[model samples]
Target: MIAPTLHTERLTLRPLALSDFEPLAEFYASDRSQYVGGPKAADQAWRTLACEIGHWTLRGYGRFGVDETSTGKFVGMVGPWFPDAWPEPELGWDLMNGFEGRGFATEAGLATREYAYKTLGWKTAISLVADGNTGSAKVAERMGATWESKLNHHIFGDVNIYRHLNSEAV
Candidate 1:
């Protein structure tokens, strides 16, 4: 089955594609990727993209590659993610290099959260932010999510969990 595409005023949240590899690898290899388990080797980045694509195949929903509507430039990936080992379903976003300071993440994050809540019928959603990643925290805040709690994940470490408001708050 084909995944659905989401549209925000300035972005198009579409399924990941092969063309995203180079950018994804560049992002993963840079210091900017630290918060998202990056600074990885090229092969590792390939595996990461493969896993992201596989997530949709297995779970029926996963992150979408974010693109700028006007330029059609790939900016990042954002959407609902729920690996079996995760504590709960999560709304996550990773902006590519040089895409920070823009409202792209905020715009895409809101759309993904709404998709999870209204379309996927989720009652609640949370975004996990690496402790020092102030940028991600700001994106969460911009989308009306509140700081929920802190967790020391086996993988991510020193994480801050931000919970999105329920439907009534939307």
Candidate 2:
């Protein structure tokens, strides 16, 4: 199941693609990616992007490449994600370095949460935010999520799990 393009007020959440590699690689190269398992080599970024693509085929839902509607510039990635190790479907979001402080994450997060519930038939969702990533925590809060528990991830260590609104709320 390919990810369908979703639209927000100022952004277009399209399917992730091989073409997204360069910009995603550039984003991952910066120190800003530390919280999301980045500051990695371009090859690592390639694998990450490839994994996102594979996610759609395996799960029928995955991250969307967020593009600014007016300029068509790739601004970030946001949507539902659930790897096998996850406790539940996740309303994940990540805005590019320059696109922060503009409410893009909040906007995209809300849209993705709605999609997760109404379209995907998910009863609940979570945002696995790395501890100390206050920005993402705030975004989750803005999307009507609240801290549920701490998850001990082998590689990322402890992460804050934010439970999103139940499907009934949608």
Candidate 3:
């Protein structure tokens, strides 16, 4: 099924498209790379986008484009990413450098969590934040996620686990 578009007061969360590769590549190519696993060549970025599309096809949902409501420009990405051998569902996000410090990540993340719990019927969600990513940790906290455990997130290296149980928090 085509995933429904999600709206926030200042942003829109929608399924990513192939057309997003360029802007996404540019977004990644610029700053904000550190927060998103570093930069990639344009070709590699396209391949990554293709893989993300495939992930959505196989898993039913994946990261959606976070766009500005008024401008419709891609600001970044946010959604669920299931890592290999991961013990639980993970909420992930990376906002463009320009969008940082504007509460976009927090707003988009909360919306994604709501969609996961209410629309997708997820009872719980987890966020694995890199130890140095204080901003993300703050967002997780704002989403009612508590620090659960520390784990070595294979893809992102060392991380702090944060948990949010829909029933208890919402």
Q: Can you write out model 1's per-residue Cα lDDT over 38-107, one digit (the tens) per residue?
A: 8999999999999888999888899999999999899999999998768899999999998989899999
* lDDT tens per residue, model 2, 1-170: 78888998998988987878888898899988988998999999999998888999998899899999999988888988988878777888777779988899999888888887788888988899999999999888888888999999877789999988798875
What lDDT score goes with residue 132 in model 1?
91
Error of 1 at 150 (Å): 1.0
Task: List ranges where model 2 is wrong by over 4 Å.
Answer: none
Winner by lDDT: 1
Q: Is candidate 1 or candidate 2 better by TM-score?
A: 1
Count: clashes, candidate 1: 0
Per-residue CA lDDT of candidate 3, range 60-159, in tens?
8888888999998888889877756877888888876677788888899988888888877888989888888898999899888899989975676788
Which clashing pairs does model 2 show? none
TM-score of 2: 0.96
Comparing 2 with 3 on TM-score, the higher-scoring candidate is 2
Clashes of each: 0, 0, 0
Worst 10 residues of 1 by lDDT: 1-10
